[model samples]
Target: MNGPKKEIPLCEVCQQPANQICGGCKLVYYCSKAHQKLGWREGHKFKCCAFKVQYSETFGRHMVATRDIKQGEMILKEKPAVMGPRMSGPAHCLSCGKKLEPMKIKEIYDFYKCTSCNWPMCGPECEKADIHKAECKIMTDRKYKCTIKYEQPDKTEAAYCVIAPLRALLMKDSNPQQYENIMALESHLEDRINTPLYVILKANLVTFIIQVLGLPFDEDSILKVASIYDTNAFDVRCLDGSKRLRAIYVTASMMNHNCKPNTRHIYLGDNYNLAVIATVPISKGEMITLTYTQTLLGTLDRSKLLKINKCFECVCERCRDPTEFGTYIGSIYCSICNGPFGNGIEKRPMLISSNPLDETATWKCEKCDHFILSRQMFWGNNALSQELMKIRKDGPEKFEEFIEKYSQTLHPNNHLVLQAKLALLQIYGNYKGYTLSELPDHLLKRKLDLCHELLELADQLEPGWSRFRGTILLDLQAAMVVQTKRDYEAEKITKEGVQDELMESMVLLQEAANILRVEPEMRPTLEAKIEELTRFLQTPE
Candidate 1:
């Protein structure tokens, strides 16, 4: 009754059928085993193999091709979700919903220990369930822009950042709405669900829901969580014992495509929901796009992120620019004036094309009568972006190597340099058990220093009333609280120490309030924290 298991023509050399497909993965037929092997050996290995499955709903706003999207048009605007103890105060374990024991708590310095998986908790009993180790490892990495870290060096000393814990929490309880929604969507996608793209979307959504909730997940409960209407995917790194798998996203996937997009995208802790808006004008019918790769680098690097991960060549406007637009302005400074110049005719006098590689590439400003050396400009800022991209390719373990190299090239206090430092801090704080007390004093100092630098940048670049700036202030305050020193005699000064700590806590809370003063709802909660800290600070001395 059934047809033969579909088999393609055999290969001539090995006489084996094609084991893979090609292009957009729309076709699957192999002629002989040798040809199949030849295809893979040639370049097929790097082709569509990484292609992910996508669903209509998961495609988000991108599904509607609202306007005449030019071949290399820009699309989509995204921001990372605010998360962790830094953003919304201290976070608890996602699995147990128990506030993880703080590493430096006054009496008992408690720490969370995860099994081989990075999922955090107080002990082994928590690991019994199919835990969120997969998502935890991915979140622990710095590439995602998540910088939560453990202050102690012991594996047991590590704990979950708010985002990871929140994801864990979502997993713990049953949500009828989420389940029904997923079921309905899954049914529609079932026929095509087996496709690689579809499979990838399904996997991304599943892992995303489970990880964000921080609880055990069932297929039925998926819909109860938010939907990934418009999202993108990241090369999330997770481990299954010695083997590692990449976490993917469907909501993040549908952010159309672009080379020089206006808005940036980030994970908001919620897998389905991403905080997105127009970095520039978003015309109707235009396929909203987001840059999956870091846009800081020039064309070559941007192309690489998309090529390797999304399996598409990006010929965006910026990428096609002969001058690399204003990105390389720092590298192409006017040699005559030895000053930066805009990409106009002003700096034409100092344009010198020494290297054959930059023959077509424009150099110097026509306005300023000064020669701008391409090589010199390349070394300053452009070089760092290129070098960092190389380092990231080596994976997270090479972070130190990347930082070391970046430090040599960029200013020690440069924003890029600070970013590299923050990456290291994240490893120490979130992934490894490097406690605050045990950390090298210099490292802690460096973390604090960078935090301040970032805060300054946030204040200057972001709008005064921007919610993002407020969130950054919140994170800084929390980090300071953790790093700040406290003295108390448990026996003699129970209530006395409590009062002092509460007072100190209020001081920190007040700073946070200044940032979120306009956010009325947050004010009450912050006030409550201040009150609680006051009460605890005043414990019967």
Candidate 2:
């Protein structure tokens, strides 16, 4: 007997062989169907799958979270996803297992034909998608060839995977307005590789096209084609130990972008999931947002990121302010005129671009009654964020200053601020000497205050019952526990008060459990923690 036929871990959902492992952090395997459903329910439906481990250099080595992760707690840490050559040579059609034809020349590289249908194979499976079927007919009549490049066997250079369905997306739709949208998308797709909106759209479109084609957009099997620098790429270090093409989707893309997103997205190795959190107190039915670009950029850089990536002029509060308002205290309302400085007011100075022969770049605040050199007032926050990334390995001590600096420079209530704070909390709470109990009273109080402020912001920024909110509630409860302990030590509170505190902690802990979610392995630990806390609260002091 052949040893039970070697039970392959078939994805319960898609029933595909789970071959590809999540490279970000190895917590899930995706054959195809299982990964997609898991990604959707677990929040990896549209993005790359991620792992459960967080890379922390804060302790000078890779550090993992000690406690059960509350939802929105940073679990996996990684660099931006990198693009690489597809590992399997001669890209095969996912549906029919047919090989894709390479573009013979650069000018004709844009054209492709379906292997089975001969309907302009964008790649092998391109013939299967309904969107491509019509276009395939049209292309078959015109005999259009693609101008895209292909990877040669001799070299390791990365090549763009020719996507067939998108080509058909250019064909006119029945609705006049919808047709116009498709045409616009076609034009946009032509130059999308250079734009941020392209990255976002590609991520989303991959999901839609996969579903329409009736192909499983699973973690291990889905194909991705893009340049090395594309932002949508995932850092799959564990699977092949090198980057390769991976699919991302757009149905999840309808949500708008923000620098400080209230909803936290997680990858389940096959799909991405979105969980709402309070980046700021959010009201019901408000727009849920995610940041398409970093929010730390100055006014000029902010505008550039938005225009380049999202393809829209951000009229958001921060973009409109010349002073980079909401970033820091200095950039707020100018002192003299009571209007925001550098916002170009009647009395305040304007930030002018000086062209030695033309006009020099400088900021004048009519409201502030002063002018600041653009260079000093306009440092690149993105560059600074990169620097912070470098120092991330240094751990909690170094981050104290960064927290203060960033909070002062960026809006205290900004989404980046929240991410940074989460990082800070992880560092402080997880590190050996940086526990909240060890901090000086004043500093500890300040930390609690900051946590409270973050919760307040989360309430406004993500109104839904998201993991982010659950994580904050857990953090707040933990801080309160420490505070109560300190108060008891100082003889400021009675034993009964501490008991009440315990009760409060129990309620908050339950709330955290209600909202926070993690991988299957960690669920047991979270449940245990909740049970332990419940028992403590139930015990008579």
Candidate 3:
């Protein structure tokens, strides 16, 4: 009493019902000579060979520098195992993640949907979409149907819990070797079960995928899939720029988290392939690290965010230092002198408890001996964030007003103030009334000052050739270019000074170009600026 062998699907390459397994891996299905040739030519053959990724327990399955990795060296680049919408509300095309037409369900149904399964698709081309095909067939076979209108906004995001796991499961049928990679990842399932998202998934996704579809997935398997996604998935922009996606990378995910990491990843091929490059020189046998959070944030916020999201309090070198590498980006204005704590340049102003690692470690001012409670700092940050959000729509004038109002209450290098200043730096050159040419000499100097100050802070927090530093470098280059031109035009500089200024501006632009060439969003803009600066430098002053 055995059921007949389950029918295998058609060729993914040609959408034909005929099946010819790949001789190399026997994972992919294709029909005809031309289609198999097309598949291999499109880079499928290389992935079929597989990457030799090693893991370890110290960093909980991490990658290392196989050799001395030079700065800006390309380490690994591969397509993600799975990709889907982020855990946020925004309706998009299920197949390609393009924006869905709002309130157009019947119209969507008429245009989209596989010929048989009736799941939403952009067109007939996506009928054989890797993750959706099997899931769609199961939904159709089990008489399960999604009741929500196809065009409903964010309906896909509401089901984020199930989509990722479903994607993982579908990968099992399509690519068994890659499925082994997925299973090898750490899920931390034991710790995740008590979380709110797990509970919700247990109630909804578990029942739908297992009970409704009768897919043979057990509770443990489903939880493991969810945990894998939670730990390994990255919020990435889609390959087509249609929408943002949570991309589950394999080797890239193995790099452990560090607040001051030596490596960074630049997504390529529309977020399909990722290039993990060294931002600093990494020696052979050294463990590679990547920052999993925004680096511009201070230690407290970075540590807390990592703990909440990744389930680990970062005790990295940056987090343990009360000085935060002498930036004092985390400290508040000392009650007495109204300056940042731990700013020990002229007079040291901070003392930590002997055990700096302890949860209750005390931070006291050396100048006024004023002890600032953790609660005050926490609430102050929240209050400032709320106020900034309220005035975010207003011009740079409002931002300056906000900064001046709290200049004494907050540290000079406080995260909020720095963020506002960064905003103003961008606005000064691009906004209508404050366009670059229209800015007064004083304002130009002000913009240049902000760029230099922020660049220095970036050197501390986001060291090496990180995206933040690259952005600041580009801003600094632009400011220097304008300032040099103004100085030359106004005859305010000697011949040698003019030459020196031009030289410095040219170097800044080239440095920025070096850093930003890897970033997809900024590369075009920075390259254009570099071309302009190169031409400007060539001309006689």
- The most accurate candidate by TM-score is 3
The reply for model 2, stretches above 4 Å from the true place, is 1-187, 190-246, 256-291, 294-302, 316-366, 373-383, 402-422, 435-446, 459-467, 518-522
Candidate 3 Cα RMSD after full superposition onto the native fold (Å)? 11.2
**Residue range 1-541, candidate 2, lDDT tens digits:** 5566776765535656786655433445677654755755775543442211232333111122232233344433232221122323454333222344556655554236555434324464446755345534544455544333344533332112334333323323434453343222212233455456345545654554454343334421222222212323222222222222332222223345554455554444422222223333333334445565544334455556555544455555444444333233224223334334334434332332222111125645533445556555445444655667766644656666766766424445433455566677665544666677677676667667766776665554344455556766777777777788788878888889888988888788777775655433336756876776666556533
Model 3 segments beyond 4 Å from truth? 1-57, 99-131, 147-157, 238-242, 337-362, 494-497, 520-523
Best by lDDT: 3
Candidate 3: what lDDT?
0.72
What lDDT would each prediction earn against the true structure? 0.43, 0.46, 0.72
lDDT (C-alpha) at residue 441 in model 1? 54
Worst 10 residues of 2 by lDDT: 351-360
Q: Tell me the tens digit of each residue's lDDT in model 1 across 238-302.
A: 12121111222433444566655534433232231343333444444444555666533444445
The candidate 1 region of ten consecutive residues with least summed lDDT is 237-246
Return whichever of 1 and 2 wins on lDDT.
Answer: 2
Error of 1 at 99 (Å): 17
> Residue 183 in model 3: shift from native, Å?
1.7
Q: What is the lDDT of candidate 2?
A: 0.46
